[model samples]
Target: MTVYVDNARIPARVGRTSGRWSHLTADTVDELNAFAAELGLLPGWFQTCKRKCHSTLPCVHWHYDVTDKYRSAAIELGAQPIDIREMGALTTARRAALSARPKGPTP
Candidate 1:
């Protein structure tokens, strides 16, 4: 699975970090997490659910929000740079995969 980093440089502050941030995502969650480890990213830093993670919803978005430093490192580490359209396609595919996941007993 190819890892992709978007060109989004939105200004933000996470914890003590303050800088433009980009998204580091992959074609699969396993690959994303594995690559994140290579980038020295903590498992806690991984973002999947947008709102409450405890919510009984399929978390389709799996990515690491990388600051400028991490973004640069990601690019240097061979993460493919992608555009907004590419991101949309990726998200759509992820959502579809989520929909296809085998479901358990409905509460």
Candidate 2:
């Protein structure tokens, strides 16, 4: 299923809840929440925390955590749903890119 969150497309309908919230970096959190509010999602849907990676902090992510039951509601406001398989392809490409990086010319 494809659901549009804040005008951006995302995946839905796999496990427990049909829809999965996409990652929203700190820079985009404010905008995402505002959009969520417009859609009528509860504040509990929002999540905030800095995950450590390479000693760098990439902005936090915000999610709506809505399920298939609530998907229609989101759609009413303009949330597009996407296929989960397609989403994995993106992750696979990112992983391949990360693995292709050079490591100081192994001797």
Candidate 3:
């Protein structure tokens, strides 16, 4: 699986602060999390299924919302630069990967 960093510097608010941010994703959650560690990101920073939403079903998106400074570091550390289309493709692949995994007993 390859790690990819997108060029989408969309204006987004993180907490009370607002800034342009990019996305860092991969074909699998494992690779994404691993690569994120190299950038000194916390595990809590990894984007996953939203806790509160209208739909009961989960949207399992595995990625990290990185700032411009982190974006540059990601690029320098060998993450493939991608466009919106490519980012979409990677997200699709990540969902598929999540789906193909074996399910555990329901709690």
Candidate 4:
């Protein structure tokens, strides 16, 4: 039930918009989405792999790219801060667990 944010020090120059950004993730999609909701993020802001060919890719992790301001808010709200190097392993484990679970009817 933990949410995670990377330690990336995003520079405003990285993107067209003038703000730092960080990647927000969790061990489960439900937890991730809930945290994002708590952060007042729009549902459309959620990012994941959409291509069928990439469905089995371990590199396809679910997350939200949040700005520095939002990152601070997320930390206040209990998102665990982690290094980018740690993300790959965390994401792989999470994705595996998610894939093994039985699917339920989509609401």
State which candidate has the highest TM-score: 1
Q: For candidate 4, lDDT tens digit of each residue in 12-51?
A: 5534667777899987788889889989998898987776
For model 2, the run of ten residues with the poorest summed lDDT: 53-62
Positional deviation of residue 20's Cα in model 1 after best superposition, in angstroms: 0.3
Return the TM-score for each candidate structure: 0.81, 0.45, 0.74, 0.76
> Per the 3 Å backbone cut-off, how many clashing residue pairs does candidate 4 have?
0
* Candidates' C-alpha lDDT: 0.84, 0.49, 0.81, 0.81
* Best of the candidates, lDDT: 1
Backbone clashes, each candidate: 0, 11, 0, 0
Ranking by TM-score: 1, 4, 3, 2
Q: Per-residue lDDT for 89 in model 2? A: 49
For candidate 1, list the clashing residue pairs, or say none: none
Report the lDDT of model 1 for residue 56.
55
Which of candidates 3 and 4 is the stronger one according to TM-score?
A: 4
